[model samples]
Target: MPTKTKSKIKITNKKVVQKKNLKEEVDVRTPDGGGWLYSDIVKDHFFNPRNFMQYGEEEKFKFNGIGRVGSPACGDEMVLWVQIDPKTEKISQCRWRTFGCGSAIASTSALSEMIVENSGMKIDEALKLKPQNILERLGGLPNRKVHCSVLGDKALQSAINDFFRNTAQHSRVQTAGAKVIDKELNVTDHDIEEAVLEGAQNLEDLQHKLKVGVFNKEVIPQLEDLLRFYNEKYYG
Candidate 1:
């Protein structure tokens, strides 16, 4: 009986497809692609931006503080200008120009409104505004687009820092990620970054410009490392 037993055969065919809502799918490939739904605030700002400086109009405004952040090569650049009220020590006016995605434009527009709308926000208060505040004001940006909002925050901070630096308020200048690389000479990462941005590409030229490691050669290595990083970040 065992020798005569025939082998049992089973055949089954099925196709399984997992379904997902458009928003839930991550990196789904489609002809039309996918993207997040922007908030109404973002849409309004992108379409009708506030306090934006059009090209060739830089001379119109007498800006006391100026700042630039991000690079065109990286696909986002922002330039912010602030007019400080001498008596109030507040930001009298805030304007900006941006070359980037919708998110960047929207974020900057929101920031401009926040700055000048309420009879001008205080300089210290304005400086305290973070990327999250802009994001929240915009209702929300996609996770991937969150970085764009940071450009607005940085540009504002940079403008404030410039105001402080120009006013000889060195103590008030808050430089993010700036470290005192040369403790002896009081050289910081910000100094090296500025030197590189000003076209000092070589270490020798940078030293000549910033005197970063003049007194302490031991700090040269650290300065060089920072230079390389900033060069690649802002220039490359």
Candidate 2:
């Protein structure tokens, strides 16, 4: 339950549950002669999962996208939803729903909370999460269970990737719309693009310009030169 604090903590390392017919893929070792779980961080979280994935139907937040990761049969799928404030590029809301062992739940819970606490954390930052860090907070994991705990961070990264992918696809929609608008305005593709590029340049220069107006005498001369040049070549 005290999953919020992961900065530094103690772990009582012990296997809370035994896997039926599971092979020992990894051997737990420490500075001493091949000791297993010299510390006990895993057992604590297993008994009381700090951030087990649970969500209400009526959760509040306006988010840009949602992402889910992991295999269901693996029994560890994490769903993450994030809401961003467009004006400030800040995370207005972040939530995670996870299914797995205590470590999985706590890791997810910790990760989501960390993101919410960070508020403006980018997807890149979220991807850096590791199971060791999560275990360090609770205490430490039974050396063998490290892989199981690592799933939480992996799922979080997958979910973050999904959210960004969706966001990028949504962003591309505007370009499609612009092409349609170009047709409707009776503007050639190249002509509209050139105009847009020029407009952007004008906008960039506006900050430094002493005078601003479409009809400004000095600006009009530059416009005339552009018009004449285009008329003589591209327009003809």
Candidate 3:
């Protein structure tokens, strides 16, 4: 009878799984078991959030531009409001509200500070601010939490777009690679693609998701065609 040979198991340092509770919320700044997930600045910002909106204070803020993103149903939502100096066109003041996790609060808090820093950032300069810049200033978030850092800039850009539209400065609106589909609402193919991917399947569903053709009934056909193309490409 042949002797049975046992297979040897090999383990590498990088593949080592730390024995710890995955359910517990570890300190992001200090490593508990999962290692440092956030930097010192992120910790400070999360603990002492700045320019955050308090309850019943929504009406008190006098803002010229407003931007909102995310949804509470998805477990994260952020709203950013800005006051632009008429003379300087700089972000005079910025306030925010976030209904999400620690990272979300910290990112928005950091953004508010950066915006109002140096006597407020210029609108054009502020619009150029990207997620990478915010992440770099915070000393970088963990790979999984990186998406949280994007919320601040997205909201800020949306607010800027609102400001441009409100001031009749349509030339300043940054489409971010989106081609305009409806001139009235500034609805773009990118917006429609995003809405469809987010689960808006029909004309009514798309309207509910993006308000794309709500006002301009004439654009319904074009909107529908794009929606169908995307749905087929992605889902079919």
Candidate 4:
């Protein structure tokens, strides 16, 4: 009989396996490794935000149009300023301030750069800059962070409306058609819609989330209609 060849078995070192497992655990606890994967461009803009207004430097900016959105109580707010070139109808400068997350900062910063770059975009063209456009420029945001991108475009539109109003172009002022729900808190239908998108399912949920229509019984019917509408529109 042929001599049986000695079989060599390969085994992975236990220490190496333990080290790899530890690395995976650590990764799961970290932001990027925990699945909050932002694009390189988003990180760049978030870390080095552009066109942000320095506190107390607002007076020196010479901006003609100003706009604000979101609520402090709701945990996100943004203010934008624009300087329009009267002769060229182009946005000469764009600046902003936001109390929000990294995505919010990055989105607004990218938007300001977009508006002011290449000799600046015309007001009409700038008005057409949607959240999708900004997301495309930033390589896109996480699904939950998508709402943050809306702050930039909405604030920009408000600033444009301010510019139109300041220039006595009343006819050009565009309204968002947001119906107020709670006068004391200054909540609106838009707020309800956002709450629904954020997982608010019913009137009590809305009340707990937004404090909307709490004391305002008159708007309950309207709020319910809005809640149903949003639930159907978004969930379906």
Candidate 5:
């Protein structure tokens, strides 16, 4: 008799995940209308934030500048300087010099903190997020500042692209680890790592985890735990 071979199974039409470590109370569609615009974290950081402000010629960071956005055309000039961690492929430092309103200043400031906190996130994932996402976490942003919200997204992307163009080799690894967000499409290595760590049996499990949201440390384990608990409770 001939020995039979086992057929391996595969997952199909898996839901794509975008943006990582999003806020649970995210209201993308309705978005805060006339309530507290930002969260305490934004307020705390915007007030003081991490590290020093106002980079100069003799500053320690000495940003060579990976990317710069805006000009007199947009009524502002934004410049981003990124310092990558040699080993972790993480953003060790993010500094932006922008000339605009408080929204511009506040939004950029909040963005720096987010990048530092979520070092594992990819540039795309980080770019996909709006300043309002940060503003919403704080008490709130003035309506006029809404425009500045997207600036953070654009500026970060420009900086990321600069990182890719200027230094493409290792950045590939960083690009691979971005988070999934609502309405996001691109996938990277970070996604695979997160999914595997989450113990996601299928794409559906990963998508569900994205809906609820994630954080820095428990990026994968949190999803995995949910899957096990959910399966035992529902599928069991």
Candidate 6:
């Protein structure tokens, strides 16, 4: 009954407005959508690593102590050399080479800087340098890459131990987590731990990476226990 009061509505045609094309700037360094953004310090160190030992330069350094860790077969290796001032008992120079990811390179570079800066850090103080300290100096590494940072400090500790041993300070030499697992290849429990951290999930994987327990059947039980322990400790 109210249809008698219906009113006419005006219809208007509106122009469709198109959005302007926006251009986004992309960084060529990170082509994969900015994957894993490293801090500027990390990037700088990675691009131009400090105290890196060039090939054939090791003979020229005259370092007082040398330490090596990890393995090329396991995908990461670090060799650290330290020159200590006997009078001051401070680390005068630190040089290192690593076969690893950018995080590893950057972390070791930062560590060498920390050791040699301010006329160098004391051997005791350098021994106190932990992975956390290196990470703090590095501005931090990614979670998965944190393991890579460990190699630098471990190698540094090994170098420090070598220094102590060289100085006939056997009492100060620390062999805390190292136990020979493969006498033939001189592989140790630490090596097995490193292999585990590098993604070796089982005995076969460990064997592939470190050749541990391959010929040394007697060490298999110990290797199994170590593998389980490291797996739980790192990836549990």
RMSD from true fold, candidate 2:
19.2
Kindly list the per-residue Cα lDDT of model 1 for residues 54-78, writing each as its tens digit.
7887888888888777767678888
Q: Over all chains combined, what TM-score does candidate 5 have?
A: 0.47
- The digit string of per-residue lDDT tens for model 4 on 67-128 reads 77775555677888999998899999988998888778888889999999999999888888
Which pairs in model 1 have colliding backbones? Answer: none
lDDT leaderboard ranking:
3, 6, 4, 1, 5, 2
Best by TM-score: 1
Clash total of candidate 2: 13
| lDDT tens digits, residue span 51-116, model 5 | 434646336674422545454345765566777554565666777766765456666777777776
RMSD after CA superposition, every candidate: 10.5, 19.2, 9.9, 12.3, 25.1, 13.6
lDDT winner among the candidates? 3
In model 1, how large is the Cα lDDT of residue 10?
A: 50
**Which portions of model 2 show Cα errors greater than 4 Å?**
1-61, 86-90, 118-120, 169-236
Per residue, candidate 3 scores C-alpha lDDT tens digits across 168-213 of 7766777886689888778777667656656888999988855667
Model 5 Cα shift for residue 164 (angstroms): 0.5
Error of 5 at 232 (Å): 65
TM-scores for the candidates: 0.70, 0.45, 0.68, 0.62, 0.47, 0.63
Evaluated at residue 126, the lDDT of candidate 6 is 80
Give the local distance difference test score of model 6: 0.77
Query: What lDDT score goes with residue 83 in model 3?
Result: 91
